[model samples]
Target chain A: MRDLSLHIIDIVQNSVRADASLVNLTIEISGEVLIIRIGDNGCGMTAETLQKVTDPFYTTRTTRKVGLGLPFFKQSAEQSGGELIIESEVGVGTVVTATLGLHHLDRPPMGDLSETVSLVMSGNPQVDIVFTCKDDKNEFTLVTTEVKEILGDLDISMPKVTRFLREMIEENLIELKLKIE
Target chain B: MTKVKSLDDLKKMREQLQSQVSLRVNSETPEKMVQVKVSMATCGIASGAKEIMNLFVNELDRRAIDAVITQTGCMGYCFAEPTIEVTIPGKEPVVFGYVNAQKANEIIEQYVVAGNLVDGIIPANYETVKDQKNK
Candidate 1:
């Protein structure tokens, strides 16, 4: 992936395909580190599967021999002088926490997180995604359920709502002293 | 700096959108509506499937098309990294590859809305027949 947001969405797609009803993602910048945590309530993974998911050549896709999402994400973090961790239980769920040096020279930009979040929601409106990002003094959160409540009978995936939400996220990130890459 | 939006702002948008927005997703009979499923696997993502997905969602909504847009896992067509499966109700699903924003728009306007065939179709909709024969 070219950017962190692409990696984020790729991982979220895994959760979605695993039939996750809810996914929680958080991005926090503290000191010189940026931490991203993605937790999902989905089909989960077995010990064997978890062990294999991070291997560069390990893949669940029968069509190809390699699955690059987790490996690339791990590489992205490590290259940025950080690390990646994953905890999963079969029939339970999975949580991935990756950290990267905020000022690392090789770190990819944050990319368009608003686009990532909105596309996931619009395509899988039945799933609830909670996104939170913070930078020391400032914090912002977008809970799909909360938005859905306020929206009443409307779909959050609607073009106008999606545009509005995108702007809202953009402004919040800017407020938190971060810019979309 | 402009204020970061809160739910209150969204509430206001909802009020205005109530008049303009279509409850199209809810009003349409799901079984009869068009289903656009974009492959969102690692290969697809690397090739910009997410942007293509966004285009499909917003464009389909804007065109007043009552369609269901979803993201699916790899269809075992790694060669066609960024592929999409479009299913118009009562018809078989067709897989299209190398889709970008332009292709998405064309799919919506011609193939999706007008039900006319377009280029880039993978022709594997008949793969089920091959599978059956193998069995």
Candidate 2:
């Protein structure tokens, strides 16, 4: 992935493919660390599968021979002096977390998060997505269910509605960025 | 944010409303709305398809154009990494090659918005499924 946002997208996609109905993506920036957490309530993997998930050669998908998403993320996190942890229960769900050194030279930029979230939302309108971002300066949460309430019969995937959601997320993140600076 | 009613209830409501507006659903099909497919295979991503995909979604939304944008696996156009296939309503799909941010903007403005063809169109190298069947 070119950026952390892209990694987040990839991870969340795994959740969606796993038949997850609810996915939570959270990004946080502390003093010197940037943390990304993705949790999904889907069919979780077994201990064996979870152990081998970070291996690029192991994948459950029949269409592809290799699965690089988790491995690539693990590599990036390690290169940036960070750590990655994945916890799963066969029937419950899975959670993946990565913490990267905020100013590390190897750390890729946090790319366009609003666009990533927007695409994920539009692609899977039936799934519920909750995105939260926190920095030292501020914190905000965006829930698709809230937006759905505001737009009674209209689909959240509608162009106008998605545009509104993207702008709302981008604007709030910009405000947080400004405050952090 | 505020608490929401049960999702099951909301889904039922949507189904009821959608049934009432079945015509609207028909109107939203691929033949009507603009369809954009960004190549997102490993090769495509290496060539920056992710950024282009992001750009397409944001720009199209900002312009208020009703479009369905999606990502697809490689179309064997590695040379044209970051390829995008655009199909306007009732029109054959057009695949564009080597699209950068500037080229993407031009596509959105001249092709998607104004209905005027821009540069960078890649000719169809293969026959369509319908054509093959007809043959």
Candidate 3:
């Protein structure tokens, strides 16, 4: 909502609630465009649910009547001179891709992305998340499975682990710098 | 710039913690320990629950408390954004409302450590789905 990372966190929560064991988020940038693509190996939706997911008023969650995650993401992309696309199949998975203008003023900043990715890991420790970003020259990726392999039976949700994870991600992202400008 | 992080670095870090008990936290009976669950719905996230979650995780670890901090969905207390449910073993769970950084600190110090009741405690005035199932 307030930032692109927040929207990302929200969308990933949907995948988590759907029991996704794997989630992949990729950010690709060209000259003037940036893409946020999130793919989840969660329980895919029925055609009925997919039809209403972007409606802002229809939600599978019984906790409340309104679901604004997708709608908000779509709006954020379009406001920045881009588009949002969601593709899914029953019993398979779902992928949400939002492309926006890198120079657009309305596009939200990629706020605290390391924290966002870390929080996602903190909450769903068992779920493996692969985060990747690329420009023409720089590329960075964080794969939880590889981290888990190294840690070997340690809980990823441990406070020290999360802190270290966030720091590593932050430094890598900063090193890459994401500026194809 | 700092050295770019790689798995090799984490491998070194793991050796230190692997020797500690933090690795075996859940394996040895979790229900006996404290459980702190922060509401993480869209409303809660927008209201700063993520920061609260980090505080609980880091501060609890700092104070050497053996509590499990986790994230949960909305607790039907939408009006009181940024809520959390704290459950100490052998005690009924209590949901606290409007939890900010200072309040979270008070919780860790007073309620969590000293076992004293604090303000802003939201009564379980209604039954949740899990509660109904148990009944």
Candidate 4:
């Protein structure tokens, strides 16, 4: 993946592919910790699927099955002196959390998060995404509901929609960073 | 650190510096400025544009090339993402796609400096603006 945000997008895609109707993504960056939690109201995986999710070689989709997204995320988190935890209940839902030591030299850069949110929103216009980003000084949240209202029936794939999403994320992050400083 | 009073002050200072720098570096000088645009759109980011953009900025700065790098929104070619548009002022702008760090380096060395086209160009049909209206 390109960076932490892109990796999050990849994992969230797995959730979308699982037919999730609601996906909640939270990113918390405070002190020396960067934590990301993604929960989806999708068909929860079975024990077999959960066990093989991080195997890097098993997938249920008809698409290319060499699954590497989960493993990569797990490896990245651990390498940064953190951990990846997953919980699922069959017929209920699934939640994946990845924590990284923000101060660790091995930790990958946060990358371009604005693009990540835009891509996910554009690709899965039907699914709802609640994205939250928090630092010690500030917090920001965006719900697909607000966006949909702002862009009525307009194709999310349109350049204008993508630009709006990117600007929203970037402007919020800038404000947050300024508050921290 | 002292903060600028207003944007107007910043603009004035920028203009002053611009003039001085222009005088210092004439067009006849061998050191030509290179401008690189990274496609940081949704599609490009999914295809690893951020990494490639960072690689370009870091490598060019480290090498001390007279370059300035920035990002732009989507160019409408989602399939060939991680696209990069390079402009060596006075020459035509070229767009390259599917860029990684390695490909970014090649573009800087081969295309930016040596004036050659690399692989992974999206066909003209997919270009966002049909004509060079902005240019």
Candidate with the greatest TM-score versus the true structure: 3
Q: What tier of docking accuracy does candidate 1 attain?
A: acceptable
In the order shown, the candidates' DockQ scores are 0.49, 0.15, 0.48, 0.05
The DockQ ranking, best first, is 1, 3, 2, 4
- Which residue segments of model 3 deviate by more than 4 Å? A179-181, B22-33, B89-92, B128-135
Comparing candidate 2 with candidate 4, which one achieves the higher TM-score? 2
User: How accurate is chain B of model 4, given as a TM-score from 0 to 1?
Assistant: 0.68
| Residue-wise C-alpha lDDT for candidate 1, range A1-181, written one tens digit per residue | 8899889888988898778899998998889999999999999999899999989899875556888999999999999999999999877789999999999999989888887876776666777999888887888888989888887876665556666777788877777776534
Model 3: per-residue Cα lDDT over B1-135, one tens digit each: 558777788899888876665454535344756878888878888898888988987897797666656677777677788999999878999999999999999998999889999999987667655466567
**CA lDDT, every model vs. true structure:** 0.81, 0.76, 0.82, 0.69
Q: Which CAPRI quality tier does the interface of model 3 achieve?
A: acceptable
**Of the candidates numbered 2 and 3, which has the greater DockQ value?**
3
lDDT of 4 by residue, A59-87 (tens): 56432345667888999999999999999
Model 4 Cα shift for residue B10 (angstroms): 29
The list of candidate 2 runs beyond 4 A from truth reads A158-160, A177-181, B1-31, B37-46, B58-64, B70-135
lDDT of 3 by residue, A43-157 (tens): 9888888888899898776666788889999999999999999998877899999999998989888778888788777667767899988888899888999888887866676
TM-score of each: 0.87, 0.71, 0.89, 0.59
How displaced is residue B54 in candidate 4, in Å? 15
Tens-place lDDT digits, model 2, residues B1-135: 533333454455556545533454455354567878777655566688778877887787677576777666556566777899999887889999899999999999999989999889888865433446567
State the displacement of the C-alpha of residue A164, model 1, in Å, after optimal TM-score superposition. Answer: 2.5
